[model samples]
Target: MTACLLPASTTLASVPIRFVEPGEDGSLEGLGDTECAYLEATGFKPTAGRIALLPDESGKLSRVLFGLGPSGATDRNGLLPGKLADLLPAGTYRFENDPDDGALAVLSFALGRYRFDAYKAGRADGQGKDGGDDVRLIVPDWIDAEDVERIAAGISLARDLINTPSNDMGPAELEAAARQLAERHGAAVAVTEGDDLLEAGFPMIHAVGRASHRAPRLIDITWGDPSALKLTLVGKGVCFDTGGLDIKPAAGMLMMKKDMGGAACVLGLASMVMAAKLPVRLRVLVPAVENAVGGNAFRPGDILRSRKGVTVEIGNTDAEGRLVLADALALADEEHPDLLIDMATLTGAARVALGPDLAAFFSRDEALAVEISRQSHAVQDPVWQLPLWQPYEKMLESKAADINNAGSGPFAGAITAGLFLARFVEKSTSWAHFDAYCWNRSSAPGRPEGGEAQAIRALYALIRNRYAA
Candidate 1:
């Protein structure tokens, strides 16, 4: 694998160094004569991610210097390291006078080093074609290297799932992904499918996915001790949304294959938790289905009974992500787990309010919300908080049923959707819902312009700290 991560032990000696900024006045506080001359010899000016090779007195090639942009670590820094991965002559190097957080720093380098070659036949034109040695990062040696590798691997797993097209990643494919992960971790998995969904009390999940040839299924994977703090994660796994009878335009359907991004995300988070061996009893519920336009497809305005025993009137067949989630969330709620989190690509409204880069998180608990925010920001996996406005509950009122799947009118769509899902959680004091846009529209350093993982990094941090401590 040409794009694999280089463990942090490689040497990057003789590389020139400079922080990229508007002015060239910042001094290298403590450097030897050789290092200082190399900097001057290279005429290194601060340009974001610009690498210049230094030379020795004997004229031998020396170290390289990379420009750090303004605001230091806070500047749109995701792909800064990635630039080095592609540009640097494959050699090991360590950051000098870096931040105290080794995990974040090391992870950033790994992310910068990420390359998506799955679809690439060969190196593209105008790209740096270095058959150089892998860049080895040098940490302070106090950090848990194994843990860092595990989390990075987990994020990669989520990325791989989301990056895959829907044709190859349907309901059955999702189950296989979960099963493989379970087998690796020594966990147990149970799958309920087809008519068994109705028999098992997941009528809403069954109704939404019944039209597709791929049988609708619910994946239940369990790990950890029975007495540990119980945590349940439910993800909306709409493999592809043809929008059912309501039908979306061809453009709308173009990326519907990424509809299961939420499921992919939670699976990623679950993988991190299990791989790290966090001290929490974890349960993952994914209701995998394809909302197709079959003759047997459930129509608009139909009343469907949910696992929570509440009747929901379908206002828009296109708003099908929340239906599968409702059933899965109810099942998760029944256990009254200490913490419940659900992730989905549930609304365009969320993207409209917060944009595609950030996920919108909704929760009734204030402290948990604050902590989640802190953790997300700390890892640069930011999430914006959306209110669960109680008044909007009236918007989902159904004349023929207990509730409507969608809100009245177009305003506050994200909040109203959150309120709808909030109604199903009978228990669980701390719950959070992340309306994520799992797809990226453009490519950046570590993050490619494809299926993306939102908020999982921050949530994973919060979970490990909350339960293990």
Candidate 2:
């Protein structure tokens, strides 16, 4: 399915078209004579997120009509058209006119081409084949096609990574994925593996990932000149979290494979930045691991030393995401980069507060928080600002160690987790933490269920707005 911002004079070129609406006979004002009669014959009603096809006298589809929920309620219903991309006959179609938000049209249309066909047999219809539809967007002469393509590809990459199951994707797989990205962007790459993690001063990362048969490693990819503004991204790379010694129920472990969603998101964001060739020294740090139970598993109550030289008392073995992230975040902080951002699926408290669709972001810098909120909302990659809440710092204090890996109480779980990470950053560097659910529990018009890149688009937008100039 292709997307285009066109003028009203532009014709449908005989492609099947549908007018979307909220009810029957709603907003018939825009219908042409041929469109009206076709709608009647198809029994088309304007149902939100519903599509009705209009066929011609020769039985060929003429056009598609979609219904808007309500006239002016800030409803972002454009993505609904994406459903038609795979379901309808393959052909070029154009938006009658430019939408108020063109990005939605551009992103959703491109995303509609997504298909999780790794091991599955080919569809008899052959709709989504190699590389999906060769879609084209008809943008205004003023719009930059390169910009649109960069963003669309970034979103598609994230969706593809998220859709792949854990069995097929793990720490080793994530490194391979990162290596591919670095090769494409002409970036430098380095990795510290298994026992090497301890020798390299990433003990926390090693401790958490030691149980898995797949050895854990720290992935580093750098691009651009040393003198350029420095930006570092640390993503939680838990390939699968089985809750270690504090074993979770079978149901809780079902989606543990997607624990690496954070890594996938940053890779997606990095693709956009590098594809756009943003002028900055970019560094991506991911400590890839699988929190599995074994004879040598790090158990609760064990004290571990972090890269930052602080002692971390394990309050809960299940709280392993932050441990791997702590070492990676500490490494990023050592550079004192202009900006540091870490993304993770660290706590269930955040999901209780904002649900799965919105990521909770924490930052000491008010300006950065505001800008992140603005850009994310603008692009529909929703994120909400949560407080660092200095008072929560006390929850992490420990008697034996400098801090507890988990908070003292259940309240403010997300904030406390953020606080635990903050301890590693001695310098008050401009850092933002994204507590995001990288998985979408259910499918939507443009967003499919499975692994997802939450807050990635907004973060990329914010970075471009700030540094890309």
Candidate 3:
């Protein structure tokens, strides 16, 4: 199921999809007595997510009816209608009463069709047990089909990368994927891997990743004009986190494969920016590694020096994401890029605070924060701004090192993690840090239960308006 956003030239006889709310079926035009009676007899209340197929005189498939539930309940998730891509029978469909935001609904429908069947032993496109042909959505003239396809494709790439198991997606494989994306966009990519990271002054990244057999690496991609506004993106690319010497319980380790979700999301955003040929110079830095446990693993008490020359005490081995991001963010800060952003699955505290559906981000720049907040609302990609509490910096203080990677107290874990990162960044004019839980525990609307792309959509919109304007 590739893009369902077919061109307007698709001449197939399209089916009309009518959205019906509670007690609103009477408003549906051209509904004959038979159809009304059928609905009444069926007790169709038009509750949310309900779908009913109507047949015409000869019992041929006619219009499709999707429910809107009770009033005020329909538009909860802007992309709720995207579920139709997976639920509806394979055919061409168009909405007749789509009173909601048309663009998001349409885009969601396009994104909803994605299914990661790569690991499936013998599945081909449109060849699953319940699938025969593609379910195509007619592109509304008002909607930009190409842009919808572009965004969907980027999100799909991130989902794909994040969904892949660690056994198949180590540091080397992650580098290859980044390289491939760079090559496609004619961007220049440079990689510093293994012991070379030490030689290149990225000690924290090397320290966190050295225990794994697959060598650690920093995948860097640079694109666009030299003199344009410089934008740098840093992502934590821990392929898998074993929690190192302070090993995690089995339950905690179950979803460790998604440790690189931040990298996947940035690459997804990069794909969108590069594909659109945005005007600004863009740089992507991903410190790829696996925090594995072995005799060579950096111990909990170890103090590792960062690329920025700050010594960090390893308070907790599980807090390695911030370490890798620190070195990468430090490198990005050196150029004093106009904008620098780093994202990671850095803390479970963020999830505890905002839940899995919402991501937490920190930004000291008020104007930029306001702009990002606006775009996030405009796009329905929810992200909450958590304060980078200055006072919490003390939580990361260490006697043996400049700062500790993890906090001493249970409070403000997310804020302290942000503060830990802020220590390495100073030159950047505007910077933000995101702590994202890049997986959905349960399927909802356009989001499936597997790996997800968080915050990038809103960030993409912000960048487009800010730089490309």
The number of the candidate with the highest lDDT is 3
lDDT score of model 3?
Answer: 0.87
lDDT tens digits, residues 176-241, model 3? 889999999999999999999999999999999999999999999999998999989998999999
Error of 3 at 278 (Å): 1.1
Better of 1 and 3 by lDDT: 3
Model 1, range 292-315, lDDT digits (tens) per residue? 999899999899999998999999
**Residue 16 in candidate 3, Cα distance off native in Å:** 0.9
Query: Which model is ahead, 1 or 3, in terms of TM-score?
Result: 3
* Model 2 regions lying over 4 Å from their true place: 1-32, 41-47, 74-78, 122-131, 134-143
Q: Mind sharing the TM-score for model 2?
A: 0.90
Candidate 1's TM-score reads 0.90
lDDT of 2 by residue, 1-469 (tens): 2232233345446352434446444456655667678768778666565566665566666666655456555654656655555555666565554544555665665666555566567544312222354443344444455676677666666656656667767789889889988999999999999999999999999999999899999999999888999989888989889999999999998888778878878888888899999999999999999999999999899999999999999999999999999999988988899999999888999999999989999998888998998987687778999998998899998999999998898899999998888888767468999998888677676666566778988888899988976
TM-score of each: 0.90, 0.90, 0.95
Scored against the true structure, residue 189 in model 3 reaches a CA lDDT of 96
Comparing candidate 2 with candidate 3, which one achieves the higher lDDT? Answer: 3
lDDT scores of the candidates, listed in order: 0.81, 0.78, 0.87
